[model samples]
Target: MKGISSYADTGRFEEISLASSSYSSILYDSIRDRPDFKAGLSEQAHLAAKFESEAKYSVLNGFSYISKHVNPHKKWGMLINLSSFAKDANLSLHRNCIYCSKAVDLNINAMVDNNYNTFYVAEKTEAGELGEDIAAMQQYPVTADTSVSTLLLSNIKQGERAIIVVPLKKKNFSHCMNFIHHAGDGIVVDGQQNKLYNFNNNADKKIFDSLYGAASSAIKPARIYITGKAPDIRNEAWEMIEHPYFPDNDWEEL
Candidate 1:
């Protein structure tokens, strides 16, 4: 009874119209000689018609929702810069050195000296409701090729510090830097050449403080250059800083 009423409200012609004309006619003729039988058949026919209409509408609404919300064909590109670490001799670039290296096995430092640190690059494609999946991707070696290169060496010379320069794609460099900081790696403080230095472990704290002081006093600004695009999560996670360099459109297909 409830289903029949719902069917009437939705106005699904396929269920009510066809049944009312075809099936109802047959039932009516068969029960014409008996008033009780005819009345009962008509009541069942109305309920059946209503149920059919509701089913059709429910299916159509479900499909519409999926089509609007599901991003089955969406794609984006992730460019990672493994170059700086790849060219550095002080850092260990071996496969067993970094976390998750065995699983990703990018061999990014192979393009540069073996002593360099290895970084990762990835591109991703998203499906309906599901997150991104790494598609065609690669990694390359990166090195400080600018005047601010001194900042890197100076931090290393300080003995317990490692200098990291994350370049801003545009004016909003803080957004990206904050992401790396919150990831539990370290705290980012101002450094030379627009670069920020972060220290994660207790051992590196002094290094961060010293670098922060030195960078603040230095006349030359630090340069933060990335060899490749960072991962999707890293990019999205950092909302404070906007990557001016990130392209406006997605390019997962390429």
Candidate 2:
């Protein structure tokens, strides 16, 4: 697994349960059950049980965390906006943050902004206290090459996975979509082959055809996170990021 895979998240995202006889994933089954491509091991499957379980449950994990601690009273407050995947603390999401809002019982006064709000991702490790200890994702500004699948996660190593949570619209809340990018190279075995795409190899042309706009990019934004290379002839505290493709969690101090 070395490239990023994107799945056009749709339909009822059931609470995944892999039966003993068959470790088939409800998410994977909804996409395709034909077993067209040969995925050697259970882990080889692009969005297998392991990957789907993580991506799907992380949402619940994050929501529970914010509801309990951030707003101990679960009252109106600001939350780390998850609208557009920006890593900078100051550059919070503009579009209504669904998950963050939901955590506070859909409190209209609960503004999704920066300030001291924390980015809720999965759950914090049991030993979490330090800033770097919390699992979070840093935003990698999408380039022309990154706009497509084949090139998005080309920089990551094989066998690892990345979760791609596509934010849904304000009107649509029933169907929640969660993408698991398992820098993987394989195919699934099931029915309904209409909603999957592997970054390494795939039969479908487009899996994310259902996704659309978030908002317009500003002419000159306040802050910008630089990924990949920091110019060879560098200046100040700038340095190269050893791993850029697998930036799963890079949040700020809570």
Candidate 3:
């Protein structure tokens, strides 16, 4: 892969990401001397959420990918409120999400405003492969890892286009699960609550099949329920892993 720096086109702002809308706008800055070029993209993203059926899960998985990358102790699923982030970033499409005002909404406008390159992320289709633990432990013969966000937003955009160079914020949490337990209720993104419960305990794990939501309609989990026909296929060991931001965290005083 070529260096991401190859994509840089900003002047003052560090070119950390990309964006695109249907038409064009002056909301964001321009591409240096190229004043014709604009920044901030939103329309395509809203349209994506409008069409996708499982956008909530996709957004959660995207956050999961982010969590894994941004020095997290673990990468369990997360929940985010569109209004919270949208309002922070000044993207006014929070009311247009397909899930309505659900905690987990995918508004690219807000994401872009918040400095995420949704266009770039939407293009991330195949994520390579499953981890050894997941591959071996999973019932089916799983191989490569596909993208969930791609499922949420295809090549769609709103009426405007802009290229925003996002500053690399120290925090990559997006205030998903790691934060925002208050401010209101939170919807478990595609039922990652199961993993949250199982993995949160570190040493302690549930032997019996634990469940969430209404008992009448309660299912194993979005992923497991889709495959595991038998309700009793919940036997698996758990272990905590140390995913450090630095390589092996071997830094010593020189």
Candidate 4:
């Protein structure tokens, strides 16, 4: 009796009763006439009945208790801006720049000039903020070895035109295409060998229209170079704006 266990805890009593009911209705003469077996089955039927009654009361009480409380979804917001990107960029600076005495002074000016606007769907965490905080929450910085992806993200805004420079990395060709698709408004500048790639024909046409004017603009074409092949460094010549990759699907009206 100690080793033999009951089905009370496992909820199998109800299953056995259901099977008994089905068998009772079948044309199995031998199964229907078994009085001793039927008498033993009465214990399982009683357990199932008790379980159902308790389950009903528990469910009703649980629902009533839950209905008395307010269930509010939590909100989250992030203000990511150029400053954070610069902080991240500092980690990637060349060893020589890190050692130079002028590094601090240079980064200060770079930070000031690297201004860009980022407006995004606000999370509950961002509620009641204004001005700079509103703009900062939308910024996303680029990661190491992802300059092309970073640049493409920087150039795009929801429903706005952008001229992006794609950095050349033989390994990240697919990442570049994904960045283009996410932008929803970007055009490849011809004659830039470093950062160009093939996009889906249908998607490319849409990007062409988004960048129509600037695509034809007379401004000096932005050069994209494979990482190691970046041209000679000039003081304060390179400008960087980094932001997070926001998907059009997740976008909500501000």
Highest lDDT against the true fold, candidate: 2
**Residue-wise lDDT of candidate 2 within 89-182, one digit each (tens)?**
3332222122222222211011112112222221211111101111232223332223323322343324222222322222121111122223
lDDT of 4 by residue, 21-126 (tens): 2322332232113232122111212223333342234422211121111111111111222233255532111111101111111111122233112111111121
lDDT of 1 by residue, 1-254 (tens): 00010111010101122223222222222111223211101111222233334223342221122122222112210112123224542221111111111101121111112221322211111100100111211111122233222334332222111213222222111111111223333333221012223243443344333322222221222222122221212222222231112231211112
Candidate 3 residues lying further than 4 Å off, grouped into runs, are 1-55, 58-62, 65-254
State how far residue 168 of model 3 sits from its true place (Å).
Answer: 19
Report per-prediction Cα RMSD to one decimal.
30.6, 22.3, 21.4, 31.4
lDDT score of model 1? Answer: 0.21
| Better lDDT candidate (2, 4) | 2
Worst 10 contiguous positions by lDDT, candidate 4: 1-10
- Ten-residue segment with the worst summed lDDT in candidate 1? 1-10
Report the Cα lDDT for residue 212, model 3. 15
Better of 2 and 3 by TM-score: 2
Q: C-alpha displacement of 102 in model 2, angstroms?
A: 17
Among these predicted structures, which one has the highest TM-score? Answer: 2
